[model samples]
Target: MVNFSLEGKIALVTGASYGIGFALAKGFAEAGATIVFNDINQELVNKGLAAYEAEGIKAHGYICDVTDEDAVNALVAQIEKEVGVIDILVNNAGIIKRIPMIEMSAKDFRQVIDIDLNGPFIVSKAVIPSMIKKGHGKIINICSMMSELGRETVSAYAAAKGGLKMLTRNIASEYGEYNIQCNGLGPGYIETPQTAPIRTPGHPFNEFIISKTPAARWGTPEDLMGPAVFLASDASNFVNGHVLYVDGGILAYIGKQPK
Candidate 1:
């Protein structure tokens, strides 16, 4: 048996319709785990279920907004009662709004924080009790490069991700006695629909990112799968509260020219 295999785990991936969430869900299903996938888009949710069904994998989809506490709790309860015990929970739903700090309205800032930060809090609170009862579980929060570094025009996103990092640590510390592990995956500018607009031909920020990233290339969704698989499986049973950066060495440099 492979050391990192999740053969009998029932994995629940939020926002599994596309991007990193989709990749992680499919990967875990391929690794022999049953998947309970959720997304805000009904079309994507159905498509995800169909994809796994065609592959003869056990999977299902639920359309629920992660930010709604009652909805999240009900969904988790239904999954536990019907689908199976979710051995691993991947909090991969996130959004970014680009606006200058001074021009950003309070509504916009709060919106971002509600989805990126509070959404996870609500979902985790809903699912963690069952995990505690089970005495073993894994929680992988998808953070971002901005978690540690500061950037302009995305203050709310930065704050939410930064908060998520500490939340992961707190959860790990609080739950480690129950044999549960919590960790984070921070991706830097991965190639996905959310990033496409910014990297288009004439986008001013594209060149800046390329120059700043030591790899000189944007990361793809596949770039994140390995980290997710590791952190979600028994391979990382003892690894908790770690914010593993999947950036292409971009955070290492201070943008200084070589002398």
Candidate 2:
């Protein structure tokens, strides 16, 4: 028995195919929010839909690249007209490219920025009008540990996520009077498909990460579900413009060096 409930709210989650997005969507469903899942991969979307349906959750999947403005606008319009007003929006679609700063090309940088940063802007712009019309909403942006702590090969990703933190705050300040709450979740190296390859012993950054993370372990997608549920539900009605770190206390350390 949970204290939080989104009994009649509708949620729109981007990047719902796998990883944190999927977990957050399912969590919202369990809390009674009708889920509208979007991902670029149709097959994975179908898989998610099936998984949710098997659980008897009200979930639907749509194929849309969150970076495309027109497509995002159309998708949101369709949802508003055909589905229902989205009371919650989770901008979780993002991509990462690991390369030395010297070797990182403008194209590569833009590619990362497009998916991680621009996509959120596009999707949030499209959905917020509906939220504003309703005079209440919740927006959660999935940031990263890099949002605050900079890293070597992930400059673009870090910049984008850092920008998202401010964007969340800015939006929250702008709409707080209208009852719209905007917040960000900065996840550490979670043991999902996204971070699995990087979690191996031989991976150069693995030991360093473990040493830095006070918890001495990588986080999982499930670790984030509770936070997402709190932010999406009425439990966090007064919480806004905050970036909650779910990083195994990694950010608290001075560096990767263990004490």
Candidate 1 TM-score to native: 0.92
Q: Considering only N, C-alpha and C atoms within 3 Å, which residue pairs clash in candidate 2?
A: none
Once superposed on the true structure, which residue ranges of model 1 sit more than 4 Å away at CA? Answer: 51-58, 197-204, 256-259
TM-score of 2: 0.92
The digit string of per-residue lDDT tens for model 1 on 1-259 reads 5478889899999988767888888788777788898888788788888777776776889999999999999899899988888899999888889899999999999999998999888888888899989989999999998889888898999999999999999999998999999999998888888778889765778888887899988999788888888998988989998999999999897774855
**lDDT, each prediction:** 0.88, 0.87
Please provide the root mean square deviation of candidate 2 (C-alpha atoms, Å).
2.1
lDDT of 1: 0.88
**Per-residue lDDT over 1-259 for candidate 2, one digit per residue giving the tens place of the 0 to 100 score:** 5458988899999988677888888888888888998888788789878877876776878989988899999999888887899999999998889899889999999999999988988988888888888988999999888889787899899989998998899989888888889999988888877567878996877887887788988888789989999988788989999999999998887765334
lDDT of 1 at 217: 80
TM-score of each: 0.92, 0.92
**lDDT for predicted candidate 2 compared with the true structure:** 0.87
True-vs-predicted CA distance for residue 91, candidate 1, Å = 0.7
Off by over 4 Å in 2: 1-3, 200-204, 255-259
